[model samples]
Target chain A: MGFFDKLKEKLTKTKQTIIEKIEAIVPVGKKIDETTIEEIEEILISSDVGIKATEQITELLKKRVKEGALKDYNDLKLLLRDELYKILEDNTSLNLSNKPSVILVVGVNGVGKTTTIGKLGHKFVSKGKSVVFAASDTFRAAAIEQLEIWANRVGADLIKHKSGADPAAVAFDALEHAKSKNKDIVIVDTAGRLHTKFPLMEELKKISRVMKKSIPESPHETLLILDATTGQNAIRQAALFNEALGLTGIVVTKLDGTAKGGVIFAVKKEIGIPIKLIGIGEGVDDLKEFNPKEFVDALFD
Target chain B: MFEALSDKLEAIFKKLKGKGILKEEDVDVALKEIRIALLEADVNFKVVKSFIDRVRQKSIGKEILESLSPAQQVIKIVYDELCELLGGSSAKIQLSPNPPTVIMMVGLHGSGKTTTSAKLARIFKKEGRRPMLVAADLQRPAAIEQLITLGKQIDVPVFHSFDLKDPRKLCQEALKKAKIDRMDPVIVDTAGRMHVDEELMQELQYVKEILNPNEVLFVADAMTGQDAVNIAKSFNDKIGIDGIILTKMDGDARGGAALSIKEVTGKPIKLIGVGEKLDALEEFYPDRIAKRILGMGDVLSLIEQAQKAFDQKEAEKLKEKIEKEDFTFDDLKEQIRKMRKMGPLENILSMLPGANKLLKDIKIDEKEFVKVEAIINSMTLEERKNPKIINASRRIRIAKGSGTTVTDVNRLIKQFNEMKKMMKKFKHGKGFKLPKIFPF
Candidate 1:
């Protein structure tokens, strides 16, 4: 562990120590006081639970306090765990929709849309399904070429166009080919245009429309890919895209590189979107389907 | 009252003013906040972790200035470190001591290489150089057209072979055209793949060998975040890079790639695209960015951007209003709108030289400003000009009118009063003299 990592590890350890300290205090069967509440709030915030979510959790705890549930520290701990688990558990499982599942990966530029698609393709292809990639981000330099490279690496067929071609047209062609080829699944990669950029975002909407033109309920899942290093902003981006595109799931990339992995919990709580996959490394095999239990366990451990 | 973050940072640094004894714990606490804020802003965690550690080592037990608080000392350390992380100092594209310096643009698709190239060409033109663009990205249908369009818009010459099958040959021919046309600085725009494919790498290598360009810049979009960092590393490792051009600096990106790329790949960021406009290209200056990260405020970037976006005549008119102390709600609203165009509230504030430390803890919500704006817009001109006219009844009416509660209306009025009072103080004094990390 280098300087920053050691410091972070120490900081996190301090946080854990604080949590353990708090955990011990709760078990002492003392009434929860203002100091205790403040400590809990600090703990939550330090854990990157986010100010909003921490406030909500505090409010919920306050309500229990108001109800004359004069609980001691153990009861408080149980209450805290139960409330956190409730908020975090609902979106735990990755939902891979019915056969020939269409996972439409979306994000702003550089969130690893192409890489995520490649990893997802490898995951699906390895599971005995014929996967095809549609390179729909034709606006950026070499976007199509990048997708083709991923497609080749994963041993999946790719539908590509010349750079600056219509992304929606490419999606149209991919869906048509997928249907005809009887492909098990199709993963369409779209450009990460700013959600505020109406024209570029409108182009994405057009791609969704074109895909539906081929398979009425085609894009079975819209996974918003976020860079895990972005922390809360990743949550904001997910919210914006969800508002714009009604995302079905999320894929948080660069987990191995960032200490802001606390964002995974925050995103799950805030957006209520299942983290379908995570990109831990750059290799095709680096992506793993999000297992919430494993994630939480790794975090606490 | 505006809580521009710049103001809050000014307050923090003010407390630290002139007392430069930085203890390890002082650095630790300050770095804790800085780390969290950067991570919150979406900066890479590893980058933040390493950054804080470096600051810790350099800052611990340091006592270099009198009358300076540990906080200010720590801020100074972090500020300098951030500048260092961003590429020690600003590095310009070597103008080819000879005319027609060759620059090759490379990066994955959607990395904004093409747009950045055009922006760079425009920058060169401003520097009084004849810039010629080569449409070497022939794989894409409109890639060439995009370059040509940008060239036309900027009035720079673009060379292309729409029917060319080989990009290598096209680059050679474009170089020849540049020499013949006496266009000393030639920028060749190449194609990008999704990932680093061998064929594309070889193609890039071939182009580099044939052109023997002075600068090979990898144009990575800041919005791509970590992926751009990875791509830059791969491209640098595979094809070798002189520098990096981070596009989409205007996007709601936490800007980790800007801090991480230089450290990871050892390539200085040559240029950055702050906006979609052809003239939005800026020379990458690491020190200014570092100060911003430490909450010292990036006044230089803010000034540069303001200068670019400011209409001098309009600015003079605003200055006159400020001089007269007649700044109205309408003007306030207009400034808010213009500031939005600059970037997020926190982002813009951090870029000001020493403003970051002042605004450390202040949270300025974009939506809250929108609410305040709505309340202001709902008022009639007379009502806007005369605050006394807003009685309790009028407050209620305005609240209902603006889809807010009377409390919200009252809050806006109260906040606006505080803001105007602060502005008056600023007008009289040195306008909140924030401590400079470096004497201007």
Candidate 2:
């Protein structure tokens, strides 16, 4: 299947929760009323669009209804599609102009950081760019081995150190290796850490510094990977990670596994970071380059 | 967006608190808000709809107590409904009379099945079960290696085959090895796959037949909102998961999956994976979860934590110090470290009434306490006992020793001194005040 079909299929549960919920609420020829608005508000919040986004959408619908813009219940679906699409328009493209443009993948452990690194490797390699994998997540015992297998599968070079090594040193070595090899892109994987942990955040900063030491403008993209299954908790993560690293983009992983796709809108609305990609399935090539229109349409359809 | 999941629930309740005897309409409004909270908490849409309907039916026009308002009645009903929806009570993994009670871990990719498998073995091992983990997750490269490495860390035996391509045969052989090794409970960490893929489900079915696992504990990410509800149904239908293990409970997530999965799949959540640490698993309690989700302080879980984390003698001493406002930097460092070890600070603070409001937006990082430890460790005994003795040069020495900038040292000292001042105020029992120590 193509990326669009795959994303649509993966988003089936999310779409059912969002679109089907609305359809169930608004019967045929039902007039828009305060109760109807309240029901919509509840649906949006439950869908994980979050409090602020739900309130905004509800308020917008109310105002538009007052203005006679939404004459029928059907109009509300179109309005929701527009509202959600507008928020998802962040990070439409990546800046791949820099040779060996480094991308740092960071999140709490088991949010698919290694898997995403592998998938991104496939994406770039498919584009015929030389990619190098950096195992900076030296704390996790299997992280290096996992990345090694992924590197081999995707035909990317890897630079790693033994587990328990200082992660920043490994990052420095990986960058230096990338420079020597003249690779087109380098993806560095950092140990997953809770953003609330200041010490771990400090560890991340040290790694970033080491990368810059090797290449002045390295790590051009610091992408925060989040599990879509999580609700508002993902927002707090985005906020802290963004505050700590000024994240350039976000990759919402496991989209196929969540009914809270509204979380995508919540992250964008809260952090204002564009979702650059979304993992639709377990396949290495299932990472879809995020298109807001397609995503919103899939939900509303 | 940064609001804690409880903050929204509390806000709706708080708005209701000021009103006099509320009408049936008021109850409807609150119930609607509660429904929204449940959904936001990641309850399934259909489940939320039915839940709200039931609560609404019970609440509307019902004669509330003279002492209690409609809001309290509604909160009680919602809390009760939440508990019921979360399987009524905690469900422990049922052990079979037969030896080698098999536990097959299943979930979608990134749902933390592998880590949870190791965590479960660690927990059972602590309980004196000769448990072993089987690496059947050959889908991801080195996944078997991952499980094995985790096994080494926790000192548990891991069964795997580097050459085995068929997961079922590998599992069968592993079961044989487990039986020979006298493993009481063999936890099989199965390959992660999408629920939509029939071939993968069949793959799980094949492993299930070979193992005939006694307990099929489905590992799920707590962050999974509505999808968790549907996924739970599919897994239950396909492989018959006995219980759900909600992973990533350490996350700031409001935990919709925990609330929704039980109602949707009719299965109890047995364990919660709070952190990535090997021992971060906790026996799931529905009442505690309901209380936390509904903005009610979870005192039961909090006391349980205090009991597990500290000795009775230590707690008594700490209590005495706090009562007397005689906290030293050493005491502060010790308490912070202990609290950090207990789990996320938010989980702890949720035990205190009204602290949820403060904790909702707060970023409580245990790592911040690590810095405090560094600063305190750098100080002299005299300085630790009497902070007034530390001069500017001494501060610089302490900062250098701690490998931190002087500014960090300064901030720590400032916060420390401020906490002291607050404790002194608090000792006088003027009022209940919570310090705004957030975003650490």
Which one wins on DockQ?
2
Tens digit per residue, CA lDDT, model 1, A110-161: 6778878888889888988899899888765556766776788789999988
> In TM-score terms, which candidate is top?
2
Q: Name the weakest run of 10 consecutive residues (lDDT summed) in model 1 chain B.
A: B431-440
True contacts kept of 2: 0.60
Number of clashes recorded per candidate: 48, 10
List the candidate 1 regions with Cα displacement exceeding 4 Å. Answer: A1-106, A110-192, A195-235, A243-245, A251-272, A275-301, B1-26, B29-53, B62-68, B126-129, B139-142, B148-157, B194-196, B223-231, B306-440
* Per-residue lDDT of candidate 2, residues B28-98 (tens digit): 77777776666656667678888888888777664563546767877788788888988897889988798
lDDT of 2 by residue, A181-212 (tens): 88899899988887766668888988888888
What is candidate 1's lDDT per residue for B167-259, written digit by digit as tens? 989988888788888996898889865343667788889889999989999887664433345566778888899999887775555576677
Task: Give the candidate number with the greatest lDDT.
Answer: 2
Model 1's CAPRI class?
incorrect
Model 1's chain B yields a TM-score of: 0.67
